[model samples]
Target: MILPVISDIHGNLSALERVLEKIDSDRILCCGDIVGYYTQPNECIGKLRQLKAISVTGNHDLACVTGDVHGFNPYAKEAMDWTKKVIKDRNIEFLRNLKRKIQIKINDVNIMMVHGSPRDPISEYIFPSTSDSTLKSFLESENADILIMGHTHTPFIRKFGDKLVFNPGSIGQPRDGDSRASFACLDVPANEVKIYRIKYDIDKVVTAIGDEKLPSFLGERLYDGI
Candidate 1:
C-alpha cells in the first residue's frame, strides 16, 4: 500500500486542500498538530476527519484540547488562544481523543508514529542537527523498522543503524527556508519513501491570517517559509 505521511498541519486549510488534491494514496498517516499557529482550524480538522487520516497527537493539539499551553511560545500561545475560541466542539473532541503514539503494521513492516520522539512523544524535537549519538541512542531503544515523527517542521529521512526515522515536515509552516507545503509518501510493498515539497498560494493563507488579526509576522512567515 502507498501511504501519504503528513504532519504539523497547523490549520492552513489552503495548503491541506492542495496537498490532498495532488496525492493519490490508499491511506494517510498524520503525525499531528492538526491545529495551531494559523487560521482555518475548523476547516482543517474537518478535512482530516473526512479523509480519515491515521494520526497521533501533537503538542499544539494537546494545548488546544487540554488547555495546557505551558510550553508554547508567545506566538503559538496567542494563535492557540484564538483557535480555542473559533473551533467547533466536535473538532475539539476530535483533538481531545487523538492518541499520543500509534503502532501499526504496513505491508509487513512494523511502524511507529509520534508527534515527536518515541521517548518524549509530544514535545521533544528530532531535527537534522540532532547528534548521531542521540539518534543512535533512540535507535537502540526502538522496536520498529520505521519511526515517523514531527515537530521540527523540517523534512528529513535519516538512518540510524538499520532503523529509519522520517519526518515529513510542516504542512502549514515550513521553517526550512522553503515556502512550500511538505509531505512524504511511503510505499510499503516497494519499501520506498519520498518527501514532497508542494507549492501553494501563500497569499491565500497569508490573507486569511491577516484578516483574522493574527500576528503580521505569522502571515509573513508563510511567504518566506521561515
Candidate 2:
C-alpha cells in the first residue's frame, strides 16, 4: 500500500491544495498543525475535512481551537490567536476532537504516527540532531516498526536498528530554507520511503496572507523558507 503522509500545514490552504493535487495515494495521514500561522484557517480546514484525513492534534491546532496560545512563540502565538478568532466553529470543533497519536498496522508493519516524539507526543521536538538515545527510547516505548512525526518543519529519515523514523517535513511552513512543499510516500510492500519536494506558488500564498491581514512575518518567510 502506498500511503501519502503530510504534516504541519499551518492554515495555508493554497499550499495544501497544491500538495494534495500532486500526491496520488490510497490514504492521507496528517501529523497535525492543521491550523496556524498563515491565512485561510477555515478554508484549509474545509479542504482537509473533504480529504477525510486521519489527523493528529498539532500544538498550533490545540492552541487555536482551545484558545490557549501560551505555549507558542511570540509570532506563533499572535498568529494562532488571530486564527482562533477567524476559524469557523466546525473547524475548531474538528481540531478540538483530533487525537494526538494514531497507530496503524499496514502490510504487517506497525506504523505509529504522532506530532512529535512518542514519549511526549504533542509537545516534544524530535529532530535529526536529537540524541540517538532519546530516539531509541521513543521507539522502544512505542514498539513500532515505523514511526512518523512532524514538528520542527525539517524533513528527515532515521533508521534505528530495524525500525524507521521519518518526518515528511512541513507542507505550509518549511524552516529548512526551502519554500517548496515537502512530503513522503511510504511503500509498505517495498519497505521503502521516498521524500518529495514540490514547488508551489509561494507568491500567491504571500499575497493571500497580505489580503487576510495575517502576521506580516508569515509572508516574508515564504521566500526565505525560515
Candidate 3:
C-alpha cells in the first residue's frame, strides 16, 4: 500500500490543494496542524474531513481548541488568535477530537504517526540534528518499523537502527527556505519512503492572508517558505 503523508498545513488551502493534487495514494496520513498561521482554516478542515485523512493533534490545533497559545511566538500566536475568531464551530469540534498518535499495521510492517514525537505528540520537535537517543525515544515503547512525524517544518528521513524516522515537513507554511509545499509517500511492503516538494500559487495564499488581515509576516514568509 502507498500512503501519502502530509503535515503542518497551517490553514493554507492553496498549498493543501496543490499537495493533494500531486498525491496519488488512496489514503492520506496527516501529521496535524491542519489550521493556524494562514487563512482558509475551514476549507482545509473541510478537505481533510472529506478525504478522511488519518491525523494527530498538533500544537496549533490544541491551542485553537483550548484558546491557549501562550507558548507560541508572536506571529504564530497572532494567527491562532485570528483563527479562533473566524473558524466555525464544526471545525473547532474537529480539532477538539483529533488524536495524539496513530499506529497502523500493514501486513508485517508497523507504522507510528504523530504530530511531534511519540513521547510528546503535540509539542516536541524531531529535527534532523537531533541526538540518537532522542530519536530512539520515539521507538522505545512501540516497535514500529516506520515513525512518521512533523512539526519543525523541515523534511528529512533518518534511519535509527531499524526504525525509519520520517518528517514530511509542512504543507502550508514551510520553514525550510524552499518555498514549496512538502509531503511524502510511503510504500508499505517495499519499506521505502519518498519525499516531494511541490510548487503552488504563493500569491493566492498571500492574498488570502492579506484579505484575512492575518499577521503580515505570515503572508510574507509564504513566498520564501521561511
Among these predictions, the greatest TM-score belongs to 3
**What is candidate 2's lDDT per residue for 62-95, written digit by digit as tens?**
8886777776788887787788778888888899
Residue 47 lDDT in model 3?
95
> TM-score for all predictions?
0.95, 0.95, 0.96
RMSD of each: 1.4, 1.3, 1.2
Best by lDDT: 3
Clashing pairs in 3: none
For model 1, the stretches where C-alpha displacement exceeds 4 angstroms are: 160-162
- 133-208: candidate 3 lDDT, tens digit per residue: 7777667676888999999999998876557888999999889899999999988877778899989999988888
Off by over 4 Å in 2: none
Name the runs in model 3 displaced over 4 angstroms.
none
